[model samples]
Each structure stands twice: as structure tokens, then as C-alpha cells.
Target: MEHILHVTLPEATARAGKEIDQLTVIMDMQGLGLKHLSPSWLSLVGEAVTVIESNYPEVLGACFVINAPPLFSRLYSLVKPLLSKATQEKVQVLDSNYPETLLQHCDAESLPAVYGGSLIDPDGDPSCPSRICWAGPVPDSQINQSKQPHAPPPVIRVALSRSASAQSLGSSEQFSVVEVARGGQRDIPVGFLPVGVELSWCVVVFAKSFLSCL
Candidate 1:
């Protein structure tokens, strides 16, 4: 980060000879999973995001977070409040259709074919292993095994008043997925929830599993 701020930025700006130019930042979080939510990993990521947004607000032209998985929202929310409003406005979280959107901002040749662009690796690898590094899931060797396995938090039943925006009328809410091991069951006590309240949820299970909403 220090090298990028002092050396990379200066050299790139000088080569381009454009005072108004800015760098485009792209973050792809396709394979991020529960394992990444470790305290140490989260702290490091939060600090980096806060520092870049706070210090180099002007250096970034725009930020595109593409191929965002379901858990990305929860992770992003942790750091979103720390960023300035200007930085927030520059960020766009996109789904699978981001390839077309990215092409609109830059030339096809500028991007690698792996991301729906014309650029290709000399060795015919679409991901361009020679030029760009692709990050994979963390190996067991690096993960901290000290995390205490705690039960998932129970959901709160939010009863809507007449003035309250109807859940149907409101936009979709982001919910995190909880994993249940074999022969294990987790309960979300909502039997007493008022009639007016609606509960929306999703569950992800491994092979040969079932869910009982009751």
C-alpha cells in the first residue's frame, strides 16, 4: 500500500499526463465463505478498506464489486459505515451480469477474456495466470482453528405498524446462511411471532438434509 501510494500512483499519473485521471478498482468475491469471517481476517480487511477510502478518496475513479456472493453483503456492511459518502457513491455491487457492465466503462481489449473481454493469455489461459493472480479459498494450514462453535443467532420478529413499510412492499432483505452438520438441528423460535409479522429466510444444507420451518 505504501509503495502504491508513493511510487505506482506517481509513475502512472506521470505516464498518463492527466491530472484528472483516476484508478479503477475491482474486487471479485465469488468464493468467499464462512471461513473468511475469522476475527483476524475481518479486522485486517476492515482496516485496509477504511484506510484506502479515508486517505485516497480522490485516487479511485470507481469501485466495482462483481460476482458478489450472498455473504458479501454482511461482510461489506461491517466496513461500509467507515467509508466517506463520496467513497460509498463510487462503489457498485453487481451480480453475475457485471461482465457487460464492466465492458461499458473500459475497452474489451483492456480486460482479460476470463472476465468477458478480448484480452487473452499468451499461454491460452483465460484467467491469465502469468499476468494476474487469482485467489482461492484459504487452506487449512492457514486457517485459525480456535474459533468457538456457537449456535446461530435467533431471528427477531419485527411486527409492522400501519405506518411501517409492508415487508412485501419493501425491497428484499439480506440474510446470512447458516450451515448445519449431520444429525444437528438449530432452532429459530418464531412460533409466538404476531400475525402481522412476516418471516423470510433461506437455508443451505449439505447432502441429504431437510428443513422444518415449524
Candidate 2:
């Protein structure tokens, strides 16, 4: 049976110590969840790839869902000082993109894909108010040949709700969310929105075969 694991950073932290307790709770919950879902399945929360490897060695690849802003703010402080002013400005602009940028850094091909929606009142129909992203069937041959660490499994799909948006991107209808392949050349329509609503972007990732033990 295939396993699905979702990892979320629940708190914003400027220091490692501040995150320890949250991390511990997350890990414990993960273990409990795994026990309930067990036999061949496991799941865990990880703040970084290394943490995932060390703590949940049996897990498949992880889906990182970051909601806090301070995490990036702290990251910017570490690197911005080394870059030129223009470069710094560009980085800031990109930084404002938030969770989308973080997911993209994990894998270039991640796109905005919707996973769930709510039914509008009165008519009791459905409407998508979130963006989704996913990548899958990652290339094994390429992974084996790369000098960098093996890539995670393809993200089949990830949906971000309207509440997740960092800022108003204008009316939701104005921005149509679609899937873009790596290199940003192709687009596949996934969902739609009304004339004035926007959604937080999300990424779907795929896990490598070896990482699938969990």
C-alpha cells in the first residue's frame, strides 16, 4: 500500500532552541500516527532534510508546508548581507512570494495544484479557492547519475487555500492557477476561481523509490 505523509512547520522561529519543543511534539505525533497506520507505513515532521534523514530514516520523501514568515526573514538576514543591494532587492521581491518560493527551492517543477474546495452556499455546489502543485514520476536514472543527493519522490499534488495567500494577488478570477513543468515552459489547467479571489500557492512533490519504505 502507498503511504501519504504531510509535514507542516507549525510555528515561526528565529532560533533553533525555540523550535525544539514543537519539533518534539510533531515527532511524537508522527510516531503515533505511524503506529495507527502501520505495518509498512510511517510519517514524520521535519524542519530540514537532514533532520528527516536522522530522525525518520524510514519515511518516504516529505511534503514541506511552511506557513510562517519569520523563517524566511531569518534566512534573508543570513544571506542578504553578502549580496549587492540590487541582488538583495531581487531576493526580497522573491522572498515575498513565500511558501511558493520555499517549495520551488525544493524542486523546480512544483506547480500550483488544488486538492480541495468548498461548496458555495445556497446552491451547495463546489468552488476552488486554493492553488495546488505537484511533481511525480521523478526520473530514477537521473537521480542515480546526479552528484547531489537523490531527489525525493514526485509530489503528486498539493492544494493551498485562499486563507494561505501571503497577500492579495487581486481578484481570484484574475489569476488562473495552472501547473508548470520544470523550466517553466508548459502549463496545464487544474482549477478555477471567481473574478476577485486568490489562493495561496502549493507544490506537489514525488518521492524517490528508496525513500518509499515509509
Candidate 3:
């Protein structure tokens, strides 16, 4: 099956290594026919909805993360309805501010974990901006601990890049698809650090197969 890994980043967090980490994981998951999709907070404006609908036609479902600057609640309310019928029904949106809250509301078995941060460095430092730390197989213990009886295996982590040009650390050999969302109303500049930054937020996408892996 053809799988694609789509990454989205605001202008600010484009250089954050965490974004690369998330994308790597999503790309790895593509083997199972899973596609990862993310929309920028800046693109949550009125007209951008049509753009998303047209561009992401094959997106079976998506996981929305709010990691950038606060968006106008009105904008969030406005653009939500414009989602494609399929996307609206299958999409799962989450808030970076509250990972635990998002976890509690959704069935963990149905999603994959999406994690990223500006602190990670992809280079030798292991602490550079836009660095991807873990892209291959996840630890069995970690998988078992998160698994439940009846649900699918959850995605471990998916990353976002603020800009397509952000430096990417780690091997891109495994990634099949890399998505970038740029040119938006709010330009959030991401920080690139010599050392790794602390991970502040995460969005996990739960899928049925993920549970079987556990």
C-alpha cells in the first residue's frame, strides 16, 4: 500500500526539532496504510478551509493539534464546518496544552502518538532544532503499557514543521511523504537551538492496527 506522512508547521515552530521527530514516526507508520495529516493554526482562517479540502482529498482522518499562539476562537468555530464531510466525521482534534485531557476524551487504542519539540537537534548534538529522535520501532514495553484489550494500536508520535525548509535531523530514508503548510495569516517563528529543547506538547493519533501491535 502507498502511505504518506504529512507534516504541518506554523512559521514560528518550523525549526523545532520536535516537528521532525513527529514526522519520522508518522512516516514509519505509513507501512500499515496509515496517513498522517495536520493543519496549521494559522491556516484556520475562513478561506483556507477550501484549500485544505482540495489538497487533502485522500485524508481518511486527521489529528489536529493546537501548539502555536492562541487563535481566535471565532476562527476555530468558523473553519471547522468547512472540513470535508469525510474529514469532519473522522477527524480528531486535540489541544497541545492538554495532552492528558485529549487522551482521556479519546479511545487510546484508536490513535497514534504525535510528539515534537523545538529542543531536539537532528545533528550529532542530539539537541538541535528540527531534530528527529525516534523514528523506527517503538519499545515493546512502552507499547504494551499503552495498549488496551479491544482497541487498535495507538500512534506513538507525529511531528510538525513550521516551514518546509526547517533543518531535519536523522535519516529521511524511511519517510515516504513529507507535508508542509506555509504562508498563513499568523506567522509563528520556530526557534532553532544548539541544544535540545524540552518537549512541551504532544498529539496522539489512535488507530485500530496500533492496538494489534501491542
Which model scores highest in lDDT?
A: 1
Ten-residue region with minimum lDDT total, candidate 3: 21-30
> Mind giving the per-residue lDDT tens digits that candidate 2 earns over 103-159?
433332222222121223234323222322122345677465756875453322323
Q: List ranges where model 3 is wrong by over 4 Å.
A: 1-45, 67-72, 95-119, 123-128, 131-214
Candidate 1: list runs displaced more than 4 Å: 10-20, 137-214
- The clash count for each model shown is 0, 22, 40
lDDT string for model 3 (1-214, tens) is: 0223333433213654443212211212223211212344345444565865676455433454444333424444666677766766554444555447445544443223443322323343432325345444677866646444644333222233332222342234322223434443333344453333333222122244441111
lDDT of each: 0.70, 0.34, 0.39
lDDT of 1 at 71: 91
- List TM-scores for all candidates, in order: 0.58, 0.17, 0.28
| Candidate 2 residue runs with Cα over 4 Å from true position | 1-68, 93-111, 114-214
Which scores better on lDDT, 2 or 3?
Answer: 3
lDDT of 2: 0.34
Comparing 1 and 3 on lDDT, the stronger one: 1
Q: Report the Cα lDDT for residue 15, model 2.
A: 32
